[model samples]
Target chain A: MASIVRKPKDLIAGVLFLAVGIGALVLLREYDMGRASRMGPGYVPAVISGMLLFFAAILIFRSFRGPQEVLAAIPLQAPLAVIAGVLLFALLLRPAGLVVAIIPMVLLGMFSISRTGLLSAMLTAAILSAGSVLIFVYTLGQPIPVLGYWFKG
Target chain B: MIELLGNLQIGFATAVSLNSLFYCFVGCLLGTLIGVLPGLGPAATIAMLLPITFGLDPASSVIMLAGIFYGAQYGGSTTAILVNIPGEASSVVTAIDGYQMARQGQAGLALSTAAIGSFFAGTVATLIIALMAPVLAAAALTFNAPEYFALMVLGLVVSVVLAHGSLIKALAMICLGMLLGLIGTDVTSGTERLTFGSNELADGLDIVAVAIGLYGVGEVIANLNAPAEQRTAAGKAITGLLPSRADMRRIWAPILRGTGIGSLLGVLPGAGALLSSFVAYAVEKKISRHPHRFGHGAIEGVASPEAANNAGSQTSFIPMLTLGLPSNVIMALMIGALTIQGIQPGPEMITNQPQLFWGLIVSMWVGNLILIILNLPLIGLWVKLLTIPYRYLFPAILVFCCIGAFTLGNSVFDVYVMIAFGVLGYLLKYLDCEPAPFILGFVLAPMIEEYLRRSMLLARGDPTIFISRPLSAVLLTLAALAILAVALPAVRKTRDEALVEE
Candidate 1:
């Protein structure tokens, strides 16, 4: 088999990190008045930023010399699904309450599970949500908001 | 000695109460169960349970939670051995040889040896804690800001070695993690660092959100992407729950050595069960007569690391209880729990609450006995759980993670943070970078920053104080040496070779 060529993503990441470190140093310098013996608030940041820059440089250099084979790629679909799930969970957490929000969250989360049918996913999600509600909300008596009108009033 | 005996009597009186003993058993059982599960860690579990402990008495709640914390260490090794997955970072080294042994049909022997070894270590560690608590507390009182800053520096450097990858890559990741840690409001000046104008970022990234996201949710995502063929059952039979005589003989020396190593390493802040397991395994590999048997089916391979991991987990409470310093995330949660109970954790804790302190120490021994009983008999049950369908298991794990994240502060924002970190974790894995060092950096950054600032303030802006303090100077020198040692070409080559083998 032909040798798998790897990308220089490490170098890119290193450069980005180095820039941020340098920017942090610059921002610290803008706000401080100090000598080595009479340091200001910027001292710690300055030191850390300097260390970060040095390490980032090493990373940039090593990425060039290191072996180049990509082991795997992160799937885009799963991350997107996870993001949507969390947002939906957060948005409807209080309004729709714990029971309502958990179902959709679980559904979106299981979207990434390969070969899982929709019916099984929905059923699994429902069971899990109900179990969590029973355990954490009802049984444990944690202060999670239930969607009862009496409580709201 | 009489006074000590009197104190022990009081402690036993406090701990032997039916309610206290019951909670201790409950905590250990739950801890072991959670520990055996692949993606759940004690920190997240404890954080989830913290609010629930509000109703219980301070002593019982603390004792039970402590049981769970150490019990999880014992439980984590099961998953590491049976499957290739480590339940926690401490168990990662156990997976190195434990899973290999499982593949060789020695899963029963490995699990039994680990259980017995952990019990032995737990017994010794509790004794050490009981005898030396006062001295350790006194020593811890001498630690100043400069010392703590130097210690954190050492921790970050040690993390590079622990990464099992290119040193430069690990350092890069550490820096990035620290940067992520700095994204919230600055502690000293009250100004935000990298919030990007988001209100949620003001209090900083919750460690629970980050950990649960990166380790738990991230693992789920990775599992989903794994090939179907590799995901099939290993079909390893776990018949016997007891090790043979020869197995016992082989593991004896290793277990003792691991206990010693673990007890010492556990006292160092930020180096706990995880590092102890790795160090123990490395030591065992170095000393074994049949060194090559390590990756095949060496019994010592499982016993030593598991014992060391448990010992480290037990003794890690030294810094937290004695010095009021929360070394890891679990200890941090314990601090929260204690604060809730109107108990201040500090140097005078043992003096102020003598019975509570001694009772907790005594209870640790009892907890260990309970763990061995709970784990050994239930090995068959846990092994059976391995046969459960992944589809069903994953959904329940997801629900647990959601509940865990939401309950951190009862905030929805934490859930969002978890999702974001989950993505980052997946990306990190794809890039072949380890998440453990990132976690160390995230956990240690704020503390390091705080200490560095305090050190400077005390020194009246003199940077020379770090060099002037003998302890700080030595620690900084060690940190520098650690970085240089790994950065050396020969060392890097050896590490690369090891990774290739792995």
Candidate 2:
């Protein structure tokens, strides 16, 4: 006998919504819920969370009814790498300035593509960093620093 | 009619002034540049440029800003078609079939059709604004809290109709968006609701951060997940820049229909521009004999939504000009620009400052014409953007996204929010939940909450306020009917059938 694993996508989405709803409800509990006529800060939010929980329950319940859409195969590397690149840019922006910050950001993003070489990636990063400095700092006068304190000035 | 023509004549004279024409050209060019880029959108662009326009006279200031408004709307479609990166909510529908058309070696056809459709829609919408400005504004003035609330409901339901995925997932996405929207300090009671002890969350999530992440960065992540060969740019497939006669014939009716829908919806308060394109696409799909062609490479799909969004953006000005009520965020910025000029926008704008009013109107037509002339040539350059390798392109796009987010508030906090949403957006896509509805929900949440609270308080906590007033009742009834239409078995069967056929 085959065990049922119907609609894994729906099942996952249901659990996701369920977590979001429960988390929202738990967070909202810290605030005061006023009466309907005279609402406090938490009145509308409490209602929204309640509704979210209700809908989430429905989503979870329906996930078990029958098999529907199959879960799509999603690769984890590209999205994570791109996100890491953005995060690294953000972390470095204030400390290292655009020229220093852009290299790793661009390198990580270039890593998302399979065929990129280290030399070419660094070359592209250098070009983009210089171009950005020219466009944003020198031309547009955005007031961004060329080198923050972290750099050996 | 003669009076209308005379007003337009006066408008032409004022708009024809050298200063007005020059400012208008500058605004349109700037708007197009930002709109084509993935990370930045028109709102942030306008906010950044707002101070620069302060030194100019009122007409030039408003005219330049207005040019940016519509020009961005036009340029946004170019990005949507070529890269599946819809920089604006209005361009999201266009990306559905527009991007597909690109993959089929019809990128040029899609872009040309969008331009032609947008031009036609802009002309018609401009005429409508001139002809029926007073009548529509007068009608719009009657909207109270309850009516506005009902309209928000209708808009949300309309967004659901436009989603091409599972209904439950879309609704869940919308609710999730609303929950996320409630993250900032509550304007009422001066209470901080969902900040989670972070000062950055005090203003709630920035819509620009959300928009850039969900659509722009999220799309990059999605694209990168595919195999290298499968993820090739569509620029290599381009054959020509003009649509065939057959394609034009297919899209014309949809274009007209979209224009009508957009013009009418644009006058309503709150999220109207975002709603019009979705509603138009939904209507086209329902009535199409070959519904399967949709979400594939249907010419009608590209033509209709493009026309609708442009028309909607144009007519959304009506409320701001005549009633002094902004229908969308860009219009709100325009109001700010007007106030900065020490001018109050309302009925008095026409009677007291006819020169400014008429000049702005006529300048819009001129600006639209300029956009077409500016955009068509740039299509070649924009298409070449697609030819760049993904490795280089992703880094450039990532940098643009970072700089744009940082510049919006000059803080890196917004970039963090963008990263978070990028992850959420990727996850939502994996689950078949669309970011479009979620974004719309974020846009509409504050307006919806304010209206709901006001309506209830005004009615002494009576829920019947939504059904008591005739207009509110009618609007709520229509919203309910729309929900039913989408939810009913027969309609679901047809939609499902279309999905299966596709």
Candidate 3:
């Protein structure tokens, strides 16, 4: 038996939109929705959410009727590695500081490439960390510290 | 005529100063450097470079940013011609005939043609901006909230109309962007709308963070997911740096036509540079004596689109400068730069910050001339840069993205925000959804809401005020007509055909 949803991408997008719209409405539920002439904080958002929901419903309906179109396979490794590297940088920047943060970030980020050897990646990370410290910290004087609580203490 | 000359004088005086000139050179150098890289588009390049301009004066920063823009346009073409890799979307068509020219050992000629054509187009486009911007600003000064609201609607719809993706998907992206944009505290009521109990969300997402994540990081991931190929320069020795007289004579008319088409199309909202080149190439092919020569080292193919993209990119600054409404993502970044400098972009900027306005316009011409020199004489330098491997490049770009986001308000929260959006952007790409309209919507959302609220207040909540005002009515009518036009099957098919070449 054929499934009702012919276009899985559209269905996913529609559901995403649905969640965002309903979530926005839920969040803004407590805010005042004053009359149109004197709109409160929630008024414009309420209107936007309604429109989003309407569009979401249409997308959901259309997904079922449209010719079957398969979504492309989403690559997980590269994006995840890159994102994890960024998350590490974010987590480390304040506590471990810029120098400590950048090396691991660059090293983890280089893992996205399948061919990169660990030695080269480590070298690249060290060079990048030093160069960034020179440019961003020494030359530009960005507010980030070189060493944070971990090293300072 | 007198006013034009006087404005030009102010522009030249400001642009010629040692301060602005130095930054302009730096900007063009950096823009060219990054734009030569295969995976780095102008948007990502600009986003990553935004942090560097934080300390400079508004005029200097703007001048440098504008230089980066057109300089990137120039560099993208160099990559397109020599390596057959378009560094940016606007250079996609240039690769068609440009790479062929390189293969035929006319690499230098092709590079020179693109540079010369772009310089010519840039000069003309700067002149157009100088003449037209003031008049537009004067007219926009009279626009009330309702008219502004209608204009934004027109811009959003026209952007979707020009988008190459599915109409429904683009519209959905617009809605999504607007919702994300509304996350901060409401300006009127001083109430937090969608902060989700987080202090980081109170200020809303920084434009720089969103831009870097969506374009810089998302693009890196996209490039990494694809099969990597090694790129080599087509010709070892690039001879014929100058076009022959016969070649010059053949290209002059196409350059003029391309500049004309690009200047006209660029003033419209959407991806003007990308559209201008596509349309210019199609027009050139249509009018050519030997249309069959287009993809096989046709100099006209190289000249017209190059001129069109440059002209289109320059003229697209019109709305951003005069109306303070960014027509594209690059303009949005420029607006972000202006905002950081405490300079609000609007019609008032013409009278209030004449130096910044005129200086930027003149700096573009200066920057264009610099690009020609840098691109033609130093062509070998850029071609050498194309050899940098993606493995090394992607990590460096990620580092920049992380630092760029961190520099935004000195907040690691912004870095986290960038990561979240980066993931969302990657997922959205899998659904075949473009991020351009989404970015535009994000930039325009607060303005749209502000205008809507003010218009409603003025009209005592009557939505009919949108149609009652003559100017607003006309703008809304155009928006409606544009939506209808794109929805029609015939027009949709033609749009598909026009964009399919890229």
Candidate 4:
């Protein structure tokens, strides 16, 4: 009730949409805005960006009048751990291969689970890596190297 | 009728093959497995499994993918009943009465009710598809650029109307999706637009990457954000896998009514299955004389929504099959699957890829039959699977997602794209904006632009061509009405109330 913005979630979403709309418009500013009969590469995008800005404006305006809406706390640890695991897997996949890439990803991802011990995490990582090799490599015949350059070299 | 029979003959012939049958079984099984688990949804699972279908023929791949969708509907009810956790949005209502029945030690009866109801609904839905898809496709065949453009507009608008949050925000999400979808080289002019001077941006964002990132990796982060807890099955043991004769008498009406509502609603462009179940649940509660018993172990509550969700899932395929328009995210992924297999889904598919189209329809019925066996006699297996903690379950899912993104083009860059979307998806969730409209808008963007551009060319820049043509005019008018309806105060209140039940 004390906050100036009535609906916090709406405020954030509106701001995000407005930024994206402006960014798109700025990016496509140099491109040709061809006639309706023949649209340039930028034509449809600019129109869409304009529409986005319009909607964003309405949302922002509405945010001032609506009953208060509370935004949920964004989870930092869980997403970060999961994203880190995936990123590491991606980075290691070609260089370190599937086996090398999967283990760390699984291990790092275990941090998302509260009160988990090292033994269980390592077990899950080992089992998951083995299973990934069996399924993605040998069975599915995905063209991924099982052992990365680090191991082969 | 004779033509319908002929088409069905082709469908059964293709669906009955050992290859198709085997893959169909695998898809239903895997789909059920994911559905029984709390965290994974059909969209994410299908996205993760997409690379696996690359080696298969188009018909088999689509059949398998479709199997996953409806199969999840069946498996979702199992978790809802046993563990008080609906596996997906469609099953959220199912958890209410279904979990109550389970707590009353009637888990067997509830499970059987769901299975029988879903099977009956699935059969009717399959037949409806066989009968209606050809006609719908024929109707769509008459559409030109202006009509298609208008229809896409209506689709996006309807999706926004059906979404559960702020109307303007959903529309904004649609525009954002369209804008993002326009990245990379422009199809008509053959010029790179939004690459930010990157080589990977040349081909545009990969559909697989976007889907997996939004639904797969993004969802995992969201689930992990929730407090962890071990889930247990309701009641000590399951028994009496068949409903009594009296229970059956009570359930038949709800199942039939639910199937009818679901079939009608599922053909619309939105989260048709999810909406149908909620609507069906509300309808049942309204009509039942003993409505007070709804949340307290009422068998009607379990039967109606289960049947509605299954039927809704089945009929949601119609729009995708006939118009090449995805009614929801799963259908979007199905279109992605077809595109990967070098097939363009449209009215012409019936003529050009009849085997794939007809076979997919037939395989749904076959998959339903398999689901009965999986859910009834094999119910114990799924109950055991419910015991697998989320902590152990999520890592495997993450691995699959990572590898799936990597395999899309065998490039690590695609994985990076997935991570970025994952963050965006989480942010959108925090802002209470649903991702469904955004995804549908993304999938339809290029087509919308193409149709709009072509329509202008046909009319020589006379925008009235959309209004001048009767069909396109009607479609656009409907779209306008949908927006106006949402903007109306009375309709807005009812819409908010409906979603508030969740």
Top-DockQ candidate index = 4
TM of each candidate vs. truth = 0.86, 0.80, 0.98, 0.98
> For residues B1-502, what per-residue lDDT tens digits would candidate 3 score against the true structure?
9999999999999999998889999899989887777777889888888888897888889889987887777778889999988888888899999999998889999998898889899999999999999999999999999999999999999999998978888998998888888889888988987888888888888888998889888988888888986465543888989999998999999899989989999988987888999999999999999999999999999899999998999999999888999999989998999999999998999999998889999999999988887677778888777766878877788888888888877888889888988888888988878999999999999999999999999999999999999999999999999999999999999998887744
Q: Which stretches of candidate 3 lie over 4 Å from their true place?
A: A1-3
* Each prediction's whole-model lDDT (CA): 0.75, 0.78, 0.88, 0.87
Name the 10 consecutive residues with the lowest summed lDDT in model 2 chain B.
Answer: B493-502
Where in model 4 is the C-alpha error above 4 Å? none
TM-score of chain A of each: 0.75, 0.89, 0.94, 0.94
Candidate 2, residues B365-478, lDDT tens digits: the string is 889888888877777766575456566776777777777667656788978987888899888888878776676567667777888888878988889888879988997888
Sorting all predicted structures by TM-score, with the top scorer first, yields: 3, 4, 1, 2
Clashing pairs in 3: none
What RMSD does each model have against the real structure? 3.9, 5.3, 1.4, 1.5
lDDT of 4 by residue, B1-502 (tens): 9998999999999998999988888888878877677777777777777788888888888878767766666777888889888877888898899988888888999999999989999999999999998898999999999999999999999998988878888898999888888888888988888889899999888877888898888888888877765455543689988988999899999999999988988888887888899999999999999999999999999899889988988898899889999888888888888988999998999999888888989999989988887668778888888777778988988888889898888889989988899889989988888888988888899999999999999999899999999999999999999999999999999998876545
Give the higher-TM-score candidate: 1 or 2: 1
Model 1 clash pairs? A6-A68
Interface DockQ per candidate = 0.44, 0.60, 0.79, 0.84
Better of 1 and 2 by lDDT: 2
Q: What is the lDDT of residue B333 in candidate 2?
A: 63
lDDT of 2 at B26: 88
The residue-by-residue lDDT of candidate 3 on A4-117, one tens digit each, is 889888889889989989999998889999989999989888888888898888888898985677667788987788888889988999899888898887887787777889
Candidate 4 clashing pairs? A96-A148
Please identify which of the two predictions, 2 or 4, would achieve the higher lDDT against the true structure. Answer: 4
